[model samples]
Structures are given as structure tokens and as C-alpha cells.
Target: MTLTKQHLVNTFEGARNNNSPYVFVGIEAEGIKEVISIPSVSFDAKEQFYNNAYSNKLVHVMNSKVKIIGLTHGYPEALTDLV
Candidate 1:
């Protein structure tokens, strides 16, 4: 589906109301929209998933216009190979 700025706005609002932890909105240069949901889970699980998504070569090859947003419990100042 093609998503405009308004769609993202609406999605964010809905996610906020639903208490969603992560909402990834991917948009292609051509305007195709892809939404990925990452619910609140253990830190390790979330990190693993995010690491996989971040390292997925297919995503980078598919499109360069990708936007990633994440909401967590607290901001931690730690960086690892998987994270």
C-alpha cells in the first residue's frame, strides 16, 4: 500500500492508544508503504529482532527509504555487535 504522511500520523496515534512499543514504517522511494509491528517484550528478544532487521541486507537492497522508530522503557547507553 502507498502511505502518505497522514497515514503515518494516524498510525502513530493508533499505536499510542494501543500502547505499542515499536512501530516501523518503511516507505519505498516509489511510495509503497510497509508497516512492521514489534510489541513490548523482553529486552533480549527486542534486541535480537531489531538486530536482525537492522542487519537484513534484503531491506537495504529493496529500498533505501526506510524509517525506523523505537520506544522502550529507558534509554540505555550500551552498544553491542548484535544491538
Candidate 2:
């Protein structure tokens, strides 16, 4: 469902409480949604590839059935490593 600001906040809070490294949250106008969280792990060369692949996959899913409206991040390291 049209991802509202509250959805973003809740998603971010959930991930933050769980100590997640990255999270992708998608929603549709009809209220269908999905939330994927990347676990905390050692950073390596493959990290970039994993991030890009998963992010693309998230976008693809969102584009296919829903509209991505916001991004709320909990991990700061994602700012440096994950795009």
C-alpha cells in the first residue's frame, strides 16, 4: 500500500531493534508489503555485489506490483559500504 511515512518509521525501528545491517521495505497502493533485512556480517568484496543485487531485486519486486515510496535506514555503516 502507498508506503506512508509511518511505515518507513516502523520498518526502520524494527530493523534497528534487530540490529540489522540493511533493510529493503516495499509497499503497494493496496496495502501489500514486504520487508527484507540484511544481517550484520563482515564486509568483503562480495558485499557490494550482494547489496546491488538485492537492492535491484527489491526494486524489481516493488516495480512489478507496488510503489516504493520511502527509505529508512538503521545501520550507519550501510551509508559507507552499501549504496
In terms of TM-score, which candidate is strongest? 1
> What is the per-residue lDDT of model 2 for residues 24-63, given as tens digits with 9 covering 90 to 100?
5333345665443444453232234333433332343324
Give each model's whole-structure lDDT.
0.40, 0.46
Q: How accurate is candidate 1 locally (lDDT)?
A: 0.40
Query: What tens-digit string does per-residue lDDT give for candidate 1 at 1-83?
Result: 33334444454556556665654443233455443444445434644444454423323333455533322221122112113
| Among all candidates shown, the one with the greatest lDDT | 2
Please state every model's RMSD to the true fold in angstroms: 12.9, 10.2
Give one clash count per candidate, in the order shown. Answer: 0, 2
Q: Against the hidden reference, what TM-scores do the models get?
A: 0.34, 0.32
Q: Which residues of candidate 2, in runs, are more than 4 Å off?
A: 25-83
Clashes of 1: 0
Quote the positional error of residue 28 for candidate 2 in Å: 10
